[model samples]
Target: MPPETGLRIPQDNRFVLSNARVPTELVADPPPGATRDAEGALLLDLLVQNGRIAALFPAGMAPETACRVDLEGRHLWPAFIDMHTHLDCGHAIPRVRPDGTIHGGFSLTAEDWPRWTDEDLDLRMEFGIRCAHAHGVSALRSHVDSETLAYSQRHWRALDRLRAKWAGKVDLQGVTICAMEAWIGPEARALADLAADMGGILGGVTDTLDRGENGTYDALGQALDRLFALAGERELDVDLHVDQTEDLSAFTIPEIAKARLRSGFKGRVVLGHCVNLSLMPPEVIDRTLALAREADLAFVSMPTPMMYLMDRKPGRTPRWRGVTTANEIRAAGLPLAIGGDNCRDAWFAYGDHDMLDTLKQAIRVFQADEPLTGSLAMASRVPADLIGRPDLGRIGADLPANLVIFQARSLNVILARDQADRIVLKNGRQVTDPLPQHHELEAALGLLDTAS
Candidate 1:
């Protein structure tokens, strides 16, 4: 098979990844439940057997029973896990105008949603997943817009089919996304129950709230209470879009933290965006962080989309950068991750579902371009934990042999290069082909064109 079909692999389950650079320590410690060798560190040839890392041997030594393929000193990183995305919406050139603002993006998305067909959605989603897989993401959590309870149920069913089809190759989890108000009442409770029944997580957006207004606080608190109640009732985890705007009135992180504390909800909560944190008053920021710590919340920052949708006022050069206060979050020891959100959709016009692309953008936006700063944790280790897969992101004995082999000598060189010469391994096999069904989407979108 051609390399594009997937990287060529030798026969047999046992193989030696020759001359690979095994890390002495993860940039961050492995999340709770990760498996490691007795020494827990090494630099040697990785021995993979029956789709799990078997052992590490010194370079140039090949076991008689195993196949050997040389990495030739290329850098190796664990496969990526995207903690948040909207791939159920999939990739489309939005019909409505993109005015380069958040509202404009939302308007475009709304206009585009009703036009989606089952076939079209499946094709586009397959394309997006293949793109992410090619870039070395093996697990992902994709948010499906729950416009209504019925639509959300149908979306989860579709995701279930996709999940079965891509089993072992990629793990896809669905998140039912809606406004906080949608989580209220009997009908909403049924919806949340259906989502859990269909193996989907609970999700809601709390991006609208007034800081000091009594009525606003009451309304917001009621909505959050209902949301958390549904989550607790369904015994489902929650991923929220909170404070995605920089407007001071839109700050909802503090309220969410307080809600967690009040409800005493012990389920895992993942928050996305929190862009207002970058612009909040110092005292408010401190309070919010302290509350988040108490609530044990994790944050997923979508810098690429945030940078695109935020701070856009026509004819004005924006003074504020459109990203979260990442430095402060990291300094406070929060489990902060960066994700590839809204790829080629109305919310963002670009992206191929590449975690490295997102991580690179995060480095620039958050000024995390320092050695041993755990920047890669945004896509790899931290997200693995957020998605509750402590077993996936670490490279060690007894770990599943999912790995990304970059054909670069160093991290800096990989960052500087185009990174086309890379291969993804899933359970010791190379992924060579995109889905055959993706052809229709490609043709319709003019992506098959060889000439510009």
Candidate 2:
């Protein structure tokens, strides 16, 4: 169990948080004499005034204030940003994929989609959003299944309601996830317009599912050209599920990059789950990354779900880690983020919408903790920037005092266990909301037995 600290704050929203261990890189314009510990963490006293960060002073140098909370060297970070998620299909546990493969998951989810009423979607999406909020997630982008216009409208409306309800708490953004071929016709333009009306991003999947039917790379390029043109016309950003397969032939990331360069689409392009890049040979990987750099492509890796769903075989040991080339993507100077892709859905059966947990999993999977100075930014600043919300990710003066403070003093201690006892401060006030009960969802989800 984690030790308890008295987390009370004053009524006037003026306080000093002393001895907080924050990542050095996250601190912007630090005061003179601000010092870092051995692990490149700044030990500082942060002053909060009128629900904003007034300044950061060196440890023990803060002026006497009306209220003071001693963190006792606990780790503090900006609230997390989950750049990729599937909230519309979230919490459909026990309706999961039969064979634990990508195709199986798709089929299973499609079979279950007919049962998704508006109320059902609202309950599940609200639950997911509340889970994310309780876990210190300040912003998230969810990919809604948009195989048909009717289905897409329903989900987008449901998301819009939740977006309004959770307006200040969780910054919610939605993306339409469809097949690449779906973007080739007049309906594609309609879908893009719908996304713009809903203030959402345009997105699709570029996998063997579409490539097999589209017949050739030329057709795929034509489809991508149309997709980018529609997005450019609507002034919407593009987020895609690209190359999420183990087959060496399933290399669509490069083509997508080429299409981006060819179309001259100036909007932001984010590619998710380029799992095949990990299996590609060095030359192919180099070429794909070069194209990505030239196209200004950003990436978000869904490590947990990819690890669970990729490279599975019956009665055989799994050989590969189903993740993308995270290190190389980061090395190429591209904006790479880590996302918690699915939760209790057909695609994956685990996850609590916790971005800290996602970051910890990413660190273990990608070996991202060696330097420890900037790794936390992947879940915070990087995704926040990708989502166009720069104010939510870093700790700086004049920013809102939205932060999560943990009992652990160092990153290693945080990685050793789930920091469930974290204190979430929004606008310099504590959020004491408890996690939603599983029983609340039991009736709607038929989860009575699963809850047991």
Candidate 3:
């Protein structure tokens, strides 16, 4: 489907790919051999109008619009859609422990609960948004803990404020990260109710049972019942943070998968992590893959955190090696995508909200020969398809004006770097550049302690 008429798209209808060879068509294995072609594989001119793709012609294309820019010697792809990024939203990252149970630089219990005030949330969110945009992320799914969701009548107002703040430039999705609080029964429902009111997907913690011992084995069933019922009543989308640990004992995933089956959820449901399967016995991996395919369940792997979070014991290879092999997962026939779960929140002092880094890590880890195309799909097509926005992921006539232009000549060489200097345009105008303002987010949070 084409974007709605009358939106801003770059009028730069002419450009060239010097020595670049676009993926033109690769077999897309959403479920094993289910492959498809993406025509016009290489050199082209990408035209934009009203923030959607207006025209794409070979090398030089004539334009009815007088504005056109040459993106010679650069690469252009669809704007990235990060399916997961915690940002500084939750008190979750920055953990002093592997389980993310601690607060900032020091002790137990973390930051003050009241620290999540409007200014705090807004400030953190803005910093995150700026970082994401700079990283070429045009759409994002970020979450604040359930504490914020329970108090959403007061807390989540930040999302509305944020929507107003960056309105036309970004597409945002907020979830009530309820794993820590799901077994609370009524309180959890209230969070779901709040999410329903706000109009977006409700993300659940379905893997808590086997995780930190704080969550019940049956807690998932209870939470899913409450959440699914409420979402059913309200028609909300479901995105579960599934199988978060290396413990093969975690049974919540199957429960949630069964729930999705019972609920008749097709594309509206998403599964975030199944890290255990990354190292699961081949038979187990095979069965799980089949289940996911049958469930129409989508996967979002946090490359940095998953690689760092699990067991590293010699005998623990099955679960701790890393949760996602982008290439393997794709070959498994599962719809997959990548997300930067950590924005240097403390627990994970690594990620930069840059998908490029995530892609590089995936290539190294997965040994993906076609890393660029793999990373681009993980950040674009897969996420877009998962979210019901296909028009925005491709570059062609009638697609959304959401596209990315990278300041690089080759994919392999570009991703080999630690960061990328790129431009993200929503409707035709550049809205973000991640590299130039890398420290902006950290500085904003008083993370550097500049603010009191």
Stretches of model 1 off by over 4 angstroms after superposition: 1-8, 23-42, 57-65, 94-97, 209-216, 434-452
lDDT of 2 by residue, 133-201 (tens): 888888889998899999999999999999999887888999999988789866888888889999998
Error of 1 at 281 (Å): 2.8
What TM-score would every model get versus the actual structure? 0.90, 0.95, 0.80
Q: Model 2: runs farther than 4 Å from truth?
A: 1-4, 95-98, 208-216, 446-452
Alpha-carbon shift of residue 240 in model 2 (angstroms): 0.4
**What tens-digit string does per-residue lDDT give for candidate 3 at 1-452?**
12222223344543222222234431121112221224323555555555565555555443545555666545677777777876434322332223332223223214534566777777766777766676667777776556444455655678767867776666777766665346356576677777777766677676554434655555565566667777777777777777676666774556776767777654377778677666567777677777767777777887777676555454445344566545656887878787878665544655667776776676666666543455557767778777766665656576666656665556655666643445566776666343434345446545544322
**lDDT for each of the candidates?**
0.76, 0.86, 0.60
- Per-candidate clashes, comma-separated: 4, 0, 25
| Best first by lDDT, ranked | 2, 1, 3
Clashes of 1: 4
In terms of lDDT, model 2 sits at 0.86
Model 1 per-residue lDDT tens digits across residues 32-80: 3233333332335778888888876665664767777777766677888
Residue 118 displacement in candidate 2 (angstroms): 1.2
Evaluate candidate 1 by giving its C-alpha RMSD to the native, one decimal.
4.2
